[model samples]
Target: MTVTAESALAGVQRIIATYAQNIDAGNTDVVADLFTEDGVAEIEGQDTFEGRETIRKVYGQFSPQTPQLHLVGNTVLTSEPGEEVTATSNLVFFARGEEGWGIQLVGTYEDTAVLVDGEWKFRRRVTKFL
Candidate 1:
């Protein structure tokens, strides 16, 4: 299957949307599945997690007990050579608190994605606080 620029962009956008949905649902296992085996998630002011196990652990920290919401927007995707793609997006997080819901953090994610077995998976995601 030939992956065109438009198709690649759409695929990446779907990945991002699914990522947010899984995270919000606290589906850590499914969230980890979105990454490559050696995928890395680097968060500003936090320890970087590498590998699916570590990624699962990071997501586990924010469990269903801690109801949260993830809002992603302003996504820009670029198709690279050799089935590689890069994307950047704005992220806003909200958590349930005594005052109902409140913003927890705002950040941007710089993502490196690659096609693995005909599927796009995250290779690396560097998250920076705004």
Candidate 2:
């Protein structure tokens, strides 16, 4: 069956939502599973995580004391038939510090997504701070 644009858009949205939820919950295993086996995640001016294992390790660095909330918005997506989908969106990072909840960073995420075993997975995501 061919994938429709609407369905692809929804799938990508779900992928983004799941990523944020898992990251906020500190479930690195699940977060990493959202990506392709060799997916790449690049954080501007920081380290780049390559592959699922590395992604899991990087996310594992987050602890209860350093909890974060990711807010995603203004998503723009483009699809190429049923093969791939690309998306760009605004991202706001909030954290609970000694004081209170506050904005930690504001950035943008450019993602490349593909279907893997009939599931949408992130092939690459580049995060840049603004």
lDDT winner among the candidates? 2
Pick out the ten consecutive residues of candidate 1 with the lowest summed lDDT.
76-85
Expressed as tens digits, the lDDT of each residue in 19-111 for candidate 1 is 999989988998898899999999889889999899998889967677889899998874463478898999999999888999989999898
Deviation from native of the Cα of residue 37 in model 1, angstroms: 0.6
**Per-model TM-score versus the true fold:** 0.91, 0.91
lDDT of 1 at 5: 76
What lDDT, from 0 to 1, does candidate 1 have? Answer: 0.86
lDDT of 1 at 10: 77
lDDT of candidates 1 onward, in order: 0.86, 0.87
lDDT, candidate 2, 1-130, per-residue tens: 6888788888888899999988898888988999999999998898889999999888788644577799998887854647698988899999988898999899999999999888999999999999
For each of the candidates, the C-alpha root-mean-square deviation to the true structure, in angstroms, is 1.6, 1.5
